[model samples]
Target: MPSIAGTYKHYKNENFDEYFSAVGVPYMGRKMMGLSSPQMDITVDGDQMTIKTSSLMRKVEYTFKLGEEYEEHMPDTVLKCVTKIQNDNEIITESVIPATGEKCGRHYLFTDDECVITLTHDKAKVPAKRYFKRVTS
Candidate 1:
């Protein structure tokens, strides 16, 4: 089985201010940062996974079987996601906002010692790319 466990560095240049801000904040009533480049570590075991960014922001942990649907709430956004194996070398996980139904597609590619994830919107517009170097300890 392909394992997805590593620290991933992400870069985002999407127009988040235009769309995310329009949705407004969840409880604080403050807008999210217009741009963010946060690094997160994702650990996947079986069909369960946890993605952590930091102490204050990382608290969500969800589990879902491959080809099954699940709900995920991250900070102020709520999304419905499905995990599937796109091919022998790649896993494709697509997420859609429950409120707006806007789709965000994510593709994870695993090689011998490297992992890459490309994130985009419904229109196939690239919003971010995350690169990870497998570590051994």
Candidate 2:
């Protein structure tokens, strides 16, 4: 698998507002998220990984073993999540909210200089894409 342990700063997004709305984020939270530029830092050690996402308005962090289901603490809610790697260069995280039965996913495709994140929710009309540039390798 490709190692994606790096620091990245978000630069652009597409359909994020709609994606957040579909995922049940409130208007104010979505607005603040839209205005904030998020930075994600990924760290991997053996079979475990941690991803820290931070922005001006919010910050979320997850540490889990690869391929193991764990509780993902999101800004709006908590979810049961499983993270896996695909195509050697992509890391995918799928989540389900037990209380509401809501589902969402995040995919991180990484390269030497950039990382592209794709956000998906079953209720969304379209997927959202966030682009990030690597700050540290």
Candidate 3:
């Protein structure tokens, strides 16, 4: 299995706008997010994992222990979330939106070349995927 700790840059996304819309983000917010190129730095220390995401809009960091539930406060909303790894191959994050009371999921598959993030919402017709290339330097 590939190591999950790495620095990654977002290069492309599929159905990004639609996914944001289904998640209740407004048009302008979605547009801004679409235009931003974010970088994610993931690190693991013992049983805890920290993910820091930075972009033009803002930077947010999340730290959680594997298979443990936590409260994540986002810019627009709050989520009840749990993150875990599957067979050491994929990082899975499951969350519940407080406002909508809807369940969502995010899957992160890591490889030597890149990491692909798959986002799924209860209200969305299909899942959205974001591609991020690993920064080897």
Candidate 4:
């Protein structure tokens, strides 16, 4: 679970927060609905996680153990997500958003030095990449 915890720490870091906030973060980007441009905020405390978005269109909150499956709703969609380890250093999550039958995949790779999150939506055939620096404990 070190990798999962590391990924959370990376996202909670001050530098990563500043950088992500400065950029106009786009998940699905220009191809999707107008609601796709929401600003994202993630909060993690131990194994619990909550994701908040600025857009009034959609918001989500959930708690799950690592390697467990959970259901959540995003903007105009409902998703079933499973968090699993891709390798010793990566946490990979695949989500199925039920509304449009869209499947999205996310990979979180962690190292002593950095962390990177890559999100790919299979329906649109497009991907978005985001990186974070490890937060020192």
Candidate 5:
């Protein structure tokens, strides 16, 4: 996989609001989440990886080793998940909600200057994509 170690700022989203609604997020909250842009900082160190996402409302950090399970607290829920590197340029994370038996995942594909994130939930009709641009400073 590519070394996705940089700060990526959210630039655009496709189907995010609808995805949020399908996942039972309130209308007002979905609207707010859709409007605000977030920044994600990813660090790769040998077999370990750390990712931190920050926005106007919240900041969350997750660290895990490739092919290992870890506790992740997402914006809305907390779950145990395994993260894996794939396709030489992609990171895939999968989680299952025990209470609801719902499966969800995220795919992060990196290019030279951009990251495309696809969010998937088994209950939702389709996945949502969030695009981020590399920040050079």
Candidate 6:
């Protein structure tokens, strides 16, 4: 498995607004997210990993292990989440709201200098893609 331990800065996105809307993010929140550039830092230590996402408007951090369930506090709702590694350079995360049965997921594909993330909601067939370049400094 590829070690995904680095900082990445967002550069581009595709269909993020629509995906956010489908997941119940308010218009103003979506607008702010669209206008802001976010950075993600990931650290891997054996079977545990920590992921931190930050932007001008919001920031959050999460620590979890592969194939384990954890509580994920999102902007809209809290979800029970699980993560898995798909291949040498890809990781998949699935989250669901127990009270509402709402489901969402993210797929991260890493290259030498960039990571492409895909966001998906169970209610929406179309997914969104975000591109992040590694921060070498």
lDDT of each: 0.61, 0.88, 0.90, 0.54, 0.88, 0.87
- The positional error of residue 55 in candidate 4, measured at the CA in angstroms, is 12
Which pairs clash in model 4?
A: none
lDDT by residue (7-123, candidate 3, tens digit) is 999999999999899878899998999889899999988889998999988999999999999988877788999999887769999999987899998999998889999999999
Put down candidate 6 lDDT per residue, 9-122, tens digits, no spaces.
999999989988887788998888888889999988777988899997889999999889999986657899999877768889999889889888899999888999999888
lDDT of 4 by residue, 1-137 (tens): 34334222223222322232233335444223232334444445655555444445455456666667788765445688987656767767889877667677778676676666776665433455655665542
Model 4, TM vs. native: 0.57
The residue-by-residue lDDT of candidate 2 on 1-137, one tens digit each, is 44599999999889989988987789988888888888999998988999999987778888999999999766557889999977878999999989889788899999888999999888998999999999997
Name the best candidate (by lDDT): 3
Every model's Cα RMSD, please? Answer: 4.8, 1.6, 1.3, 8.0, 1.7, 1.5
- Model 1, span 1-137: residue lDDT tens: 45566665544434444333344434233233323344556666776665555323334455567788888776667788988765555778889988777888778887666667666775433355555555521
For candidate 2, what is the lDDT? 0.88
Any idea how many clashes model 6 has?
A: 0
Give the C-alpha lDDT of model 4: 0.54
Whole-model lDDT, model 3: 0.90
TM-score of each: 0.61, 0.92, 0.94, 0.57, 0.93, 0.93
Residue 28 shift from truth in candidate 1, angstroms: 15
Model 3 bad stretches (over 4 Å): none
